[model samples]
Target: MDIKQRNQNAIDLTFQNVTVTVQTKQGKKLLLQDVSGICKSSQITAILGSSGAGKTTLLNVLTNRIQNSKKVQVNGKIQANSTEINFRKFSEFGAYVMQDDVLLETMTVRECLQFAANLKVQGDQHEKDKVVQETLKILKLERCQNTLIGGQFVKKGISGGERKRTSIGFELVTNPSVIILDEPTSGLDSFTAYLLISELKRYAINKEKTVVFTIHSPSSDIWQLFDRVMLLIEGQFIYQGKGNQSILNYFSNQGFNCPRLQNPADYLMSIMHQNNKNAQNYPIYFQKYDSLLKPYVEKEIEQGEKFEILSYKFETSFVYQIQQIAKRSLNNVKRNPILFRARIIQAIIMGLIVGLIYFKSEGRSQVVFFKLIVQILIYLSKDGSNHPTSIRDMNDRNGLLFFVCINQLMMSLKPCSVSFPSMRKVFIREDNSKLYSPYAYFFGRLIIEIIPQIISPILYGLIQFYMVGLNDRTVGNVFFYFLCLILNSLLGLSLGYIGGSIFSDVKTAVFMSPLIFVPNALFGGFFKNRKNLASWIRWIEYLFPIKYSFNAIAANEYENTHFIPSPTELLNLEFSKWECVYILLGFIIGLLTISCFCLVCNRKRQQ
Candidate 1:
């Protein structure tokens, strides 16, 4: 294991004059200062330093994962196998594993790998199955093939090492020629960390793959496993070379003594921290590293004259991706009781509450708008003032009729917001791995998501439709109500999808979702008059699905009936019932389409 992994034809990754400057409120700051190095194939190059040493930043630059923003400046030339790196081509072959494990907890280990295989490997079911079996064996996860990944809520399954191995196996399924990881063993025990690194070393050697990772506080045994080591302090490389006694000697000669039996990893980290602390007075380590190691790096760059862009490779077709992802999404839903069943129960309870309030309210409509507005804004504000309603008119007919639509819309919004944010990390990990197109994942998820939206609303609608005594003409009304409910739910999901994809964390999505829905709910015709709204601001009515959905529900209940002398112009019930349905369908399709585009664009920029 002490010997450097090597294969003559393995890819050689070289970078020179790499500088990354990012903008901040105060000014532009250099995160990586002219860093340069070579990570030859069949070798494990570990970047080590104290926190904020720009170790991860360096990895991002080499892998072309750095965010290209107008506020950020990147200056560097990176060559792979003698040709300069081409982002489109490099993205096809290069695999990156983040510092945290991003996995679907509802799925079992084998199921997870199989789905990844189906997404990444272009072949029949047998071929995909073979890849899954081989990956399970290679990662030594055969025993836990059926064990769930588990989570904070579900029954626990597997261990820390197994989870990390699963993450690595995700990239390995694509058979990548180059693998980059950020702190792969951050939370594992020392022995487990040693084993994981050992397995990585084997991947590099046997598969002829280049391996690079950012690590913190690796054990002494783990330190010896890396083929090369790069040390950083304050965004500058302090050392980059073989991990051996020579490296220890390099620092020892610089007045930083390594105590007997001291772990080299810890010793290097301590010295780098000290150097960063006293850089103004003490001799800088980067100056010595540059002066001594310039020749080696320069020679490597000179020798890499055959670099060429690695063409983008997607094994599976877009249709295949959609099919496989759809199946996987359905499978995940089937396995998780909370994901699939809890929503129905929630919908039932909501139905009961609304039904009791509006029970047999077809003869009375004044309380309708007031109750619908109250339900919509309940999650937004603590006080009644947040939702101004008029219960003064007993003739405010069809107000309760419109509650069905507003109730479903608000209900659907939570599930959409809750579910998408939860799955965003998992989607990003698999999607970026080149497993499938963004459309495949998006549509597949939308399809599976519509299942709950369809079922939950049916239950709520049936219960409320009967309990509230809309039973006289319930047949036609129920069918249209159900369709509108599904569409409105999807609209909610799309809004949530946008917030979930745009924000990195679920907490942020949760905080922002309600605020976002405020405009939709207020302009939905239940809370205020749309026609009275200013001309410029009135356009927002077309943007939110709530407006169309409420209109459709009101039209279904009021048209040809003496429910009111004449429907309020603000209700805008000019259209027929079928027209309302078409409008709702339009909103559903449009919102999801926009959401998917924004997410795809966001992911592209992020990459």
Candidate 2:
């Protein structure tokens, strides 16, 4: 269906006898208690409440967003067009704009709407673009259409008001039957909030779409924009009726009058405060609401025509989902180059220092000091063919190779640890909107992250290869060495991806890296010979990526060796060079699969 057809499917939403309770240590605590209300099509309904008044809880219950388990119970019947509906059916007709704006900071306002259109709007490219343009005009965001959504780190783009409007436009592109926002006016100045509310009221009237939102601290002008108002206190309704003089009259008849020249919203909020003397009269107000208003609302809720709940089908293909996700990720990478630039600089500096430290030590004793004369003589005389590989030389070579493996692993791992956790909220919000599947997101992000993982290792390998005098200095050997380094880096990156997917906090992910890496390094056959460890524990070495990577590089280095002591035999590594390479590839795939599994688990937890 096109935008007009979808908008014409406007629905009247009703929730009845909704109660939410959480099992606490002491007892079950109620968040919302037997609340019932009807939000009609083509009207703006406002849920007003003070802090801890359960306004958001009621909204969540109506939208079927609250997670229900044994510890948390939700008992409610939500209807769309008077037909009982489940969460999936409700989500098909409704779009929720969250309190915090979750736009991709690198994307412009127009691009943000276009992305939603690509995923949600039914049509081809031209049709989706038309919807996006229409949404831009409707939201009055045409002037800043090309401006970025900007976050804490990115360069400034739009103002907070524009960002909020862009967020609204994102949902509007789908032309949903019902739109609900949680605290849309939050964090905006008085004038900006007034303008936003005016736009919302106009949109509701023009489109005939049901609009519902929770608000706090609305000025008198903002309050007057609502077609219907529902006042909540301590999880129960104190008032639910028309927003004009009728509400003032109802409260006045109860001996709580709005003073002249005072904002009605302010006066109402003051009385709703739990600590106010007016709060002691809440019982009387509740009795009056139950005696007078409950019957009328229940009757209105029962009048809607039955509607068939059609399942929502995604408009975009899987490949197109990946394509769009990757495009957004690339835009983010281009704008936020600080991390990538730092990784490059870190590789260059570390490679230079490490290569110089191990410079041409193949034939020399491990005790070679930095004396000028001796160093000059060694530089002139250093040749692989001059001296056979001694046990000491084998030990030194193993040391350098092990160091390279650890360096690539840590360099790749540290940065990726924070990547997924930082974007968790954005992913969850978009996932709830049904933009794409977890598999699409996983592969799309991996496609972009692999580029840097490849580039950094190649740079480090080129710098350290010839300088360390590894494996006869032949092109074939250099290629193999570089290949091993790149694979190790990717394996490290996969581990990092797994770590980030598992944790929701950056600090926790970083702190746990050493705890994971240190044990793996110990069993990697460098610190302790695997032959001497207990057989049960020795199997653990096969599980870590480090063992295979170090083994592969050392095997490649010592392939045609002329040493008296064979390093491979001395180290007791039984895997052939190619076998280790295959194992490294397996580990990379396995780790990535585990990361995707973790991402799926995270999604389930969010639901």
| Top candidate by TM-score | 2
lDDT of 1 by residue, 326-357 (tens): 88878778877675677898788988887787
Per-residue alpha-carbon lDDT of candidate 2 for residues 1-607, written as tens digits (9 for 90 to 100): 7755554476888899999999999998998889898998789999998898998788777777887898999998888877887666766778888888888888889999998899888878899999999889888899999988888778788998899999989888887778999889888899889988888888888877889999999988998899999999888998998997889999999898999889999999988888858677889979999998999888888875455534556557889889988988888889888888888888888888887887777564232223423433444322344233677777777888898898899998988988888888888877877778888998888898888989999888766655666664344555788899899889879999989999878899898888767877888899999989998777888778799888898888877666766677888878988999888888899999999999888874222
Candidate 2 vs. true structure, TM-score: 0.93
In model 2, which regions exceed 4 Å deviation? 1-8, 309-312, 364-388, 604-607
Q: How far is candidate 1 from the true structure (C-alpha RMSD, Å)?
A: 7.5
Each candidate's number of clashing pairs is 8, 0
Off by over 4 Å in 1: 1-9, 249-260, 275-284, 305-312, 360-397, 471-478, 498-504, 514-545, 562-572, 604-607
